[model samples]
Target: MSIIEARSILILILTMPTLTRQGSFGSILSSWSDSNTRGPTISLHAAAKPLMRFMYHRQVLAFIKKNRDTPLSKPIMEIYSSYLAFKHLSPSTKTTILAELDVRIASRADANAVAESLLDYAANLLDSPDANVRISTWRVLAELAHHRSTATAVLAVQPYRRLVELLNHKNVEVLETAVCALAYLTQWPDGAQAAVSPEILSCLVKLLDSPNSGIRRWTCLILGDAAQHQATEMAVSGHLCIGLISLLSESDSEVVENATYALSWITYSSHGVEATLNADILDVIPALLKSPTPQVRRWTCRIIGHIALHKSRASILRLNPCSMLVSFLSDVNVQLRESAIYALSWLTQWPEGAQAAVTAKVLQYLPALLQYRKPHVTKWLRRMLKHLAQHEAMALAAFRTQLVPLVRLGTLVVSSMQGRYSALTKFLMWQTKARLWIPWRGEMGREVNDVFTGMFGGRKRRENGALIPRTS
Candidate 1:
């Protein structure tokens, strides 16, 4: 028929109120395939594909809107079977439907409900032989994985193995989208568990060198999350450490942030720490500590803290990060401040680090942190102050600053015992001093002191009109 006739028919179908109605929608689709309707020529049918796809998309959206306030299971399944599964629907049409669903999944509060219902169909589509279908499916899964409520559901379906398989796909877009899905999925503990396999890590490590910045960024994010697991941390400690450290110098800020975050987790192990040191991570750490991104700085401090927990304090001392870490105590970001305090806490366990921290005036910045209510921040802050108090100069500095009442008590306790205990005893004393201090006057103080004296195998006597514990 004529072009005008086709336009007239398209408008009539689009304007029909019943076109998107429950059962009538399928009848319209069936009309396109039936050969007996008005004897339309082959070219006329071919010419209507775009308009047909548009009508299908419009109907799918209208159907969703009409049912949006209600339970989505029946309507979503209907859309899936009618539009997504129809044999004659073009790949692009299906992709459009999935894309629209992705938008809804991302912006709506009921996204988990939609994702839960769509997971089975989406999982089946992941195995489609069509590359476009696979890419669209990955995008939908990625959006689903973004929600914590739906992330475990995504994991339960076990699509990670299929995602790993796509890492080798020749299409760069497919590889990028696949890694993006893995990046979101691995953020959860269960997802990370599924992602720690040998094949997955190998693919991720290879993608670190991908020419596409997004692949490298997503790969780092996946590795970073996966590296939190003990098995994954040790597995990533080898050559992967070198690859991630190299990415620290990349011009992309996201790659650097994620790479640093992954390194922070990996370096939690002794093996990982040694590998990172051998990789010269220290050389870049100073710069990363000053990174414009708060996350990068926070992760960089975490890397230093993990390394300091090892026997390699001497190596980290050479970096002299105490002043930088101390500076972070005054930072606006509470998390960065927490990370800095954590690193300083580990570093100051050594006498040399304590002295460096004193020289950096860490005491000046610490009093303000006492006002912060975060338990982790307070825990690390207490450790950092206690560590600083172990050294005489730092203790004197704390006394001068009148840092905190507890810190002052630590100073008095440590100073009273100086030259009386062995180095190991002194360290152990500081580690437990917080629990040993008692604020009572008279009998309570005496009893607490006696307990401390007994624990150290010492006897107490008056010296210069003050009680002193003498090791016997």
Candidate 2:
């Protein structure tokens, strides 16, 4: 028996446990490698891993490059070829190879060996019954385009057309790669965009709503990238933005985050943003503010801020669409709270009531924030203080009203600590100082004047009726 075959048998015997669990495939791989050292078996073993891996990856990609006709080796060769192509050089080298391949791809007769090999993978993959293999072929074809823009452009059309056919791919990897390829190809305005038929864009929008986060994220990024000028025209003509807005509350945080960022980009362009506004898709913004992930929350806030700044300036001026943003200030997550603060600050600069709505909502949280002991929490408080000072007219009055309660709580906590936890006492004292209260009682006395004045008008007396000096 050949060395590879014998090794394969040995591995199957000794590593049944590993093979059954698919843990490492190490024994199997080692067996195959051993078998490869033998003459004819070497060729067979070379194609074996590619074939097996292809069964799992389902795409003839950068694994094996043998050109056998069976379902087994073609996929293997496709991957091996890709591996060879990518390994030879960087993006620049790939670009150079692609540049050279373009002239040859123009006609069947003139096609160079490499270009034809790539096309062969593309065509064969499209014809394959396996959706994964077909999707893999599309990826290879798309990568081919990345090098030779000209050849890639020409090559991309058929693959692009073929991609639309695979929209129904059951495999998530296939669907994700296919749409991402389309997104990347269509980035250029020239030939790539021209190749995207109306049906393709429609299919892409459907994928945007796929329960799959990968699909949704890629689709949004693509649609958003394409939503410019003529690309915007094509996207709207195909009805894409509404679907994107629909994803604002997507269950996946990464999807929601990317979708929000993409939507923002799509809206920045005149026609793109106008189309979204005309669709009246503002209602989705508030819900995203409550996204469980901080990244999602931050992106959602930024997007809303962008929309309010540009297309929805009038809507923001009235604070009609920002009620959810005001509510976000009370979110348990500090990052989310700060995002809400930033969003409100930006909106408030334009709208009259925006600042008030934010301050009114945030003041209620001062009691809770005062009790928070984390260093990050203190940093957040400092940011809040800066914000309060910046919008002093709007936030200061509210901060002044709320500060007394917080200080009173802090004092109560400090007073009650009867040496039970010296560390806790030191931390609170540090917080009080970091929070800018050295002479806590003395500082509080002047600060409470505002709170007491609102309660006891004409309070010229300090209990004994001695005139209370205005400390401001």
The TM-score leader among the candidates is 1
**Candidate 2 per-residue lDDT over residues 90-177, each given as its tens digit:** 3332333333334333433333344445664446546655454455555555555444434553353466656666676776777777
Off by over 4 Å in 2: 1-133, 142-158, 168-174, 186-196, 211-213, 228-230, 278-280, 317-472
RMSD of each: 15.2, 22.5
Each candidate: what lDDT? 0.75, 0.54
For residues 1-472, could you state the per-residue lDDT of candidate 1 as single tens digits?
9999999999999998764535434476677576375664569777787778777767766876776566446556566656766655667767766776677776545566666567767666777767788788888888888988777777777887787779988778889888988888888878887777778888877899999998898888888888787756777778598899999998899989989988998899899999999999989998898889999999999999999899687788998998899888888997898888889989988999888888898877755666666767667766776676556456556644644343333322344353333221332234443433432335534544654565455665545533346656
Best by lDDT: 1
Model 1's alpha-carbon lDDT is 0.75
Please provide TM-scores, in order, for all candidate models, with all chains considered together.
Answer: 0.73, 0.44
Q: Distance from true position, residue 210, model 2, in Å?
A: 3.3
